[model samples]
Structure formats: C-alpha cells, structure tokens
Target chain A: MILTEMMMKVTPIKNGTVIDHISAGQALNVLKILGIYHTTDATISVLMNVTSRNLGKKDIVKVEMRELEVGEVNKIALIAPGATINIIRDYEVAEKYAVDMPDLIVGVMRCPNHNCISNTDEPIKSQFLVKNKNPVVLRCLYCEQTITENIADYLI
Target chain B: MFEKRHVLSMREFSREEIDAVLAMADTLEPYAYGGNCNSLTGKILALLFFEPSTRTRMSFETAMMRMGGKTLNLGPAEGSAIAKGESLADTIRVIGCYADALVIRHPKEGSAQLASEFSPVPVLNAGDGAGHHPTQTLLDLYTIRKESHLDELSITLLGDLKYGRTVHSLAYALALYGAEITLVSPPSLRMPDQIKADLEAKGTTVRETGDLNEVIEEIDVLYVTRIQRERFPDPREYQKVARSYKITTDLLKKVKDDLIIMHPLPRVDEIDPEVDGTKHAVYFRQSFYGVPVRMALLKMLIGGDDID
Candidate 1:
C-alpha cells in the first residue's frame, strides 16, 4: 500500500527513542507526555495517520538523544496502551518493548478531581492506582475518584 | 488500627475495620447519650469547616466535648486565611501544628486528602464536595446496624443517586456486608454506571430502576436523598425530575411493616410530614448515632486504651 511504503521511507534515528503503534490521532497527546512543546535541542519527528499492518492507522514519535522514562511511559500507556517503545543507538534498534503500566502511580499526573487534595493549595502530591491497564482506568488513591473517559485531559 | 491515620474514603476501610468501628461505637453509646465519659481528655481536635454544615460540625464538636476533649473550630473556612488567598496546604499546616487531629470539611472533593498531606496529625474527612465522606458512612453503617442488621437486608436508595455522596459511600459500605442494593431514581438522575460496575465487581447484587413503587415491597431499608435543584446544569431539567419521587405515609402502605426509612437530613420537601411520625422514620435517630460513631472514631484515632 502507498501508506505502508511511505512509512518505510522515513529516516531512522541514530540515538533516541521511537514510540511506535500509537493509536491513530494521539500523536499530540504523546508529545504532551514527552513535554515536547517548543523546539528542543534534540531532533524530534512526529508522524500521524501512518498506515500500520496491525492497526489501520497509527502515529509515531521519534526523539533523538533521549530515552523514555518510566513515568513518561506510564502516561503514554494510559493514552496508548498498545504502543511499543523502541530505543535507538548508533542508527540501530537497541531495545524494544511495550510500555508496562505500574500498579501505582505517584505525582506523574494531577487527579481529575478538582476538589482532590492534590488540586488544593496543600502540598499533597497526586497519587493514582491503575484500576485497569488496557483502557487505562485510573482511580485516585486519596479521593477514590475514577478517571476512564478522559485520560488525556488529566495527563500532566 | 486507625491510630493517627487519615480517613479519606470508604474504599480505604475493609469489612473488619468497619466492624471494629461499629463495635467501638457500641461501647461508646453511653457517652453519646450525655453520660459522663472522658475518653479523650486533654486531646485537642481542630474543626476546619470550609463548607456549611449544621449536623456534621455539631456532632463532631459534641463527640469531643462529651468525652472531655476540647476543639479549635474554624467556622466557615471562607472567613479564614483561605479567604485572603491562602492555600489549603498552608491553612492545614497551621492547624496541624496546633491540634492532635484535624476534621476538615471543604467544598472541593479531594480537599480532605490534601489537608491530610500537610497536617502532621490525623485528618478526618467531614465532606469534600461530592467525594467520599468516611465519617458519615460510619454513622450510616451504625444506623443500618441499629435499624435492621446490615446483613441479608434489601436496600432501596431513592432519589438523586447521581450526586448523592452519602448514597455512593453507603452503597459501597453496604456491599462489604453483603447487602442487596436497589437504586431508584428518575432517568435523568440515575446513579453513575461506574459505581454500578464497582458494586458488581465486589459481588453485590445491584438493581437499577426508575420506578420505586415496583420495588418498595422487597426493600427493608429505604434510604431517601433530596433531589438538589443545583445539580442540574439546566433548570428546566431539574423541574422535570424534581417532583418525581417524594415519600409520603400513603406510599408506605406497599412497603414491608418493619421497613426502616433513613435520610441524610436538612431534607427539603422529599419526605412528607406525616411519614415523620411513623415507626419507619429512623432518620432522626440515625442522626443521633453520629455522636457515638464519631466518638468511637475519635477514640480510635486519638489512641487511648482507657475510657474513664
């Protein structure tokens, strides 16, 4: 297919991380997860609506000179659970694995509850439990308020 | 087991812990009845009520005072440093330094948890927006235990289940004791589907319906909550479901003879005046149980063995 052929033509990164198989149309959310708002010193490439063998359409994010952190991966897993993380070194894939969400998340994202202690003026850090991983159901440990529908909106 | 701990949600308590609280409440009943008891003498409690509450606030104060303990009350937090743009953290930190325990009621859902983070002492959730109310749940469980044992009884929760924090917490607590729950509300004000799934996951039988008359006969406890006019974004929607489910003495004809009716009071026009005189009306007594339950909670949290 034309889309698959074009996907193969993109240049490979020498030393960086490649987030592959992001559910189509979530590349911007992935960028937010990586904290890549403005132009950074490192090279960054984001491909949206790319054709995939498994998924009909997908998005990919490539960042040079930086590997993904567990907290970042956790945020990504909430939005794109099936996405794979590929670390590239010297123009070859060095490590490849799917993001594994942690059972408990601390201070990564703010609680969706506006009244949550985390959102208050207090020094309380947000804490969440992964109630479900596949669709990313997060329950606030303090308030017990569940966030399933808008996982992206609450992502820090 | 709950010594110097933060009571934030009903989810934090297990069946055994709930049983323990109820047992302690049973032990402290005499003090709740104005008997002389000094369980928490010299212990100081800080009452931080950021919201307006007559029952919860007074009950906590009474619980401490009856047990020979004192309170530092910050009436209507809007007047505190919070009004002058101080963060909830700063205010809690200041109070935490002064008191052995903090009782906070805020307009925000997670405010108690936030206060617990800053306070060095134990933090008790009075009510946080629409979030969990652990103390209220304790009183509710106590009421349930008193009216008609918590186990093996069918419960019908009437009216606005959508925004009723009491109903949400009560349902979760009741499930721990294997109570069959039936939720009755207008279609527009139904209980959230997520709560239904959570109850089912915990192995509780939950039935949802719009008609209360159809399920009234099978119910042993009818817990009614008012349909707040503010919950609706559009006032027109509120007008439609407002009068859909009011409890009257005439409606009690279809219910079981031993059925117990309860409400988290400051109720507005939901239960008819005639029903207040019926034997089923245990809501006032339920409100009375708050004193003993809270006294039990203070004892558990304050960490003293002897109740003088």
Candidate 2:
C-alpha cells in the first residue's frame, strides 16, 4: 500500500508551468535556484528519478501559479538547456518555453581561468563573444581567453 | 579577424586560434632567428614583472623590438608602487592608458586576472600563480611540432608534476592530439587526480609511477621540472626530495641516445648544468622561441586592427 501510494502519487495544479527533460539529479538544483521549490504563496510539486522514454531517467516539477521572468529564463537557459518549460492553464497544456543561447553572453558562464579577473573574490561578469558558432568558441571580452563550448562546463 | 584579447588560459583557445598562432609563428621564424626586425612598427608593449622571469618577458620584449615595436620594462614591481598602497587594479588601469598591450606577472594566484579586469588595453598573463602560462604551453607545443612535424609522439614528463602548470596544460593539449604521456613524478607530488581522470577520459594512455628509471629507456622527450620550494609547508620536506629527482649525466647512461631534454627553467639542482651542453637540452632554445611564438600571438590579436 505504501509502495502503491509512493508509486501512484500525482498532483494536478489549477494553472501554472511544468519543466521537462532535465537530466536526473539536477532538477532540485534548478528548482531551488528558480525559487519555485517552496514558498508560502505558491504550491509546488516535484518528481525525481522518474522513468523517461527519451533519457531513461528524468525529473519533473510543476509550479501551481507562477511563471518565469526574463532573468530566471536566462539562468535556466545557461544552467539547463536540455530542460523544457510548459504552460499549464486550467489543468490543460497551454504553451512551452526554451532557453535562448545569446550571441554574446555576459555573466552567464564563469571564466575557467582561476587567476582570471572573472574568478576574483570581487565580482566581474564572464563576458564572451561568440566568435565561431560551428564548433562554438567564446572569446573573453576582457582577458582574451578563448572559451570553447567543450569547456563551457568549467565556466558555468 | 582577431583584435585585442588576452590568451590567459589554454582553456580559452580553440583549435582554430591555435592553428592561426602556429601558422604565424612559422611565418615569423626566419626573422626571429636571423635578420632585420620591423613587423610591429609604432606599437608599444608594456611588460610588468612582479616576479622573476628570464624567458617569457625577455622573449616578448625581444619579439617586440625585433618587430620594430617598442616596450617599457618595469622589472620586479615590488619596490615600485606595490610597496606603497596602490592595488594591481590601479597600476594596470594606469598602465593600460600608456600602452597598447600589457604583459603582466604577479606572484599572487589571481593577480593577472584581476589586472586584466580594468586594463583598457588587452592584458596578457605572463605567468600567474601557477595558474596558466598558455603562450609557453603553445610554444612548447610549437617546438614539439617543429621537431616532430606531426603532433603525436612518445613523451615523458619526468619530475615535479604537481606545481608545474606547464606540464598540466601541455598534458591536456597532448591528450587532444593523441600523444602518449608517461607521468614520472614522486608519489608525494604526483599529477593531480582530476587531471589523471581527464586524460583517461580523453582516451590518452598515461602511466603513473615514482620510478623514472624503469620507464627511462623508451621515451623521446624528457620534460623535467624542479620541485617548487614554495609549494612545501616545510623546508626540510623539500630538501629531502629535491636532490633525488635531479637529472644528471650518470643517470643518462640508462637512457636512449637521442632523447630530447627540456626544462622550463630557473632551475636549482633538478637538472645538472652539464646536461646543458648536450644535444638533448632543447629548453634554452625552447625559451628563445617564447618571443617569436608570443610575437606571433600579439601580432595575430592586434594586427587585425589594420584589417577592420
């Protein structure tokens, strides 16, 4: 019975949003930073280690009555590009959202160089010019470090 | 069209940029070793060294002068404004106004990064607190390719893996090229665990052990590094390990005949001075190439000023 409740639990929201296809284990990190995890005002639902047809394992979060702002959308784009956002209106699926990769990203990806000004104790934005997009290389606008997409994880 | 950027870390350069720098270095090779200078006319390079440097600073300055570029040298900025209360930020901000490009060195780990923040002109990290000297790594790669033509080769990094940022960056670049690397460091100062994992993930074969003697017979390039005294908490720990790692003539009897020896210098007893006269010692020449390689770099970054 406990296993049935644990396995069969579901929460239907009146209207809000749903995020999908986030790589497992990072959804909590995403939701916590997004400020939708828990608040006195907004009801939240979370599902982790869920079975997925595409990723084999996935995470899902449903927000009862909140929508993402521009800054939150940009952060989502930078941190979780694989994630997709959907609009839930009156318990019906409404619209979807995807993060945009900006041509020149500032303060989104961290600079990988430890001695780089962007990595100092004082705050500085990690600025990049999308020099070559085919292979995806970012040139540091300040120090001239050429940040490649392969190593973007280090900066982010 | 490259213009006004700092190649602070190897992580920043893509394959395309590396190709460009290498191609330009090849073009500048003749003028670098032999005759007249004048590639960089009416340009100014300001080299600010707060730490001791022989190769990188001299090479950049030499490359500048050789290209008909002028430079202002402020060696060892300790007794300079730093002894007073002026921050690295203020100094570089002031210098950025004076120079078209700045090459800076600082002992603190993030000083170069901090300096680059406010610099109006592009700031090049000469060497920053064991963090990265990407130009040196590029030149090292340059020398290896010039010698071997093809990038991949049998190579061995023989000593001081932990503190040598050059070995770390070069090793990562080598893995990208499918070069086999044997890391021969003492157990106490082995290559960092993360780096080893990264190399393995890249599918590069890396053999790790304290004994260089066992693997000494098969390698081509014997890249040596001094055990950095500054890294140790205790001076006695450094003294005990430093002497054993020294590469000497007697040790060479066990090795192959044509092995190339290289060291990023300011050596203290790690490499015997006698090894200097031999054909294997390419480090001095390696040091000499820093200028041309960096000149190639500075030119590629700023020369596009004319292009646009």
Question: Which model scores highest in DockQ?
Answer: 1
Weakest ten-residue segment in model 1 chain B by summed lDDT: B1-10
How far is each candidate from the true structure, as Cα RMSD in Å? 3.7, 7.3
> How far off is model 1, as Cα RMSD?
3.7
Point to the candidate with the largest lDDT.
1
Off by over 4 Å in 2: A1-67, A73-123, A126-156, B1-4, B14-20, B50-52, B74-94, B107-120, B146-152, B230-240, B304-308
For residues B166-216, write the lDDT of model 2, one tens digit per residue.
899989888877788999877778998878998999899998878778777
- For all candidates, state DockQ relative to the true structure: 0.54, 0.16
Compared with the true structure, what per-residue lDDT tens digits does model 2 show for residues A1-156? 355653466666778878877767667666754755555577777888788898888888777787665456545544456778887888887888775555677666666665565665444567777676545667666555676654436434
- Candidate 2: Cα lDDT at B153: 75
Clashing pairs in 2: A110-A155, A117-B113, A143-B6, A144-B6, A146-B12
Evaluated on the second chain alone, the candidates' TM-scores are 0.95, 0.88
The chain A TM-scores for the candidates, taken one by one, are 0.86, 0.66
